[model samples]
Target: MSKLLVKLVVNALFTVPLLLYLSNATPFQALMASLSLSILAFFLGDQWILDEFGNAAATLADGLLAALFVGAMGTAYHWGLSWSALAVIAVVTAAVEFGYHLLLRRWDVRWYS
Candidate 1:
């Protein structure tokens, strides 16, 4: 539950602004998309990859998955999606996620087994 809370907050803090300030998404749209992506990342990146391969590997997976996720969501909303833009977002998000994982370690909090 704590982990989920972190996911919600962190994802919202980053994604909401990115979508709202930088893209065409409304606040409600940003909220929905952020939560959706956070849950998906928690399952795939934290659960499936993090335990097995550790932070670096999991972070890499997160980047790739994020690119795909943001792209799909952008398309769904008819935002002007582009590879360059998505790549930039992916890099920034991945860096933040890497730090977030480190914070989890510092807090002695594990999101998954």
Candidate 2:
């Protein structure tokens, strides 16, 4: 699938649920925040993933970025402080990513190696 399409679909899927569950704000606010963050994540994350992964980086990046964006948005919205939310998101994302890498290493999957 095209990267743009993947981003759109993933963003919607991620954002909708987060907005529904975490944010006390209106749906539009949640949607807007989610969309904006998702876009930023897609752009930055695509490059990071490509540099880290390879040919399959697009797919991996899409999923990772979507998760990170949604998590960040939810954390921020729930906390009602931009800085705190960002910090939580970054910490959580790093932990999750590290855990994923560790899992891959333990499985001896050469993909991340």
Candidate 3:
């Protein structure tokens, strides 16, 4: 749980700022997007995919997921976000996620096991 919280915070730190800068998301919208991405990434990328596929694959999955998620959100909300902007957000978030995965491995959290 605590580890998940850390993931959420780290993801939010990167994602919220990018959302605000790259899209027309308000503060609340940005926060919600960040939180939603964080949780989804935690469960899907971190827990399931990481355990099975390791860091590199999980990182890639997370990045793609972020791009799809943000792109969808942008469309739904009329945020005027471009594909290039979504790519930037995904890359940055993936970089952060890579380091975070390293940290998790180093710390040996292994909650599921």
User: Ten-residue segment with the worst summed lDDT in candidate 1?
Assistant: 104-113
Worst window of 10 by summed lDDT in candidate 2: 95-104
**Candidate 1 local distance difference test against the native:** 0.81
TM-score of 3: 0.94
Off by over 4 Å in 1: 109-113
Question: Which candidate tops lDDT?
Answer: 3
Q: State the lDDT at 67 in candidate 1.
A: 88
Candidate 2, residues 23-54, lDDT tens digits: the string is: 46578776787668656654665445644764
lDDT per residue for candidate 3 within 1-113, as digits (tens), equals 98899998999988999999999999999999999999999999998999899999999999999999999999999999998999999999899999999988988867346
lDDT of 1 by residue, 1-113 (tens): 89878877987888778777667777888789888888888888877787778899989988888889989999989877678778876877788779877876777655453
The global C-alpha lDDT for each of the candidates, from Candidate 1 onward, is 0.81, 0.52, 0.92
Steric overlap count per candidate = 0, 0, 0
Query: Residue 31 deviation, candidate 3, in Å?
Result: 0.3
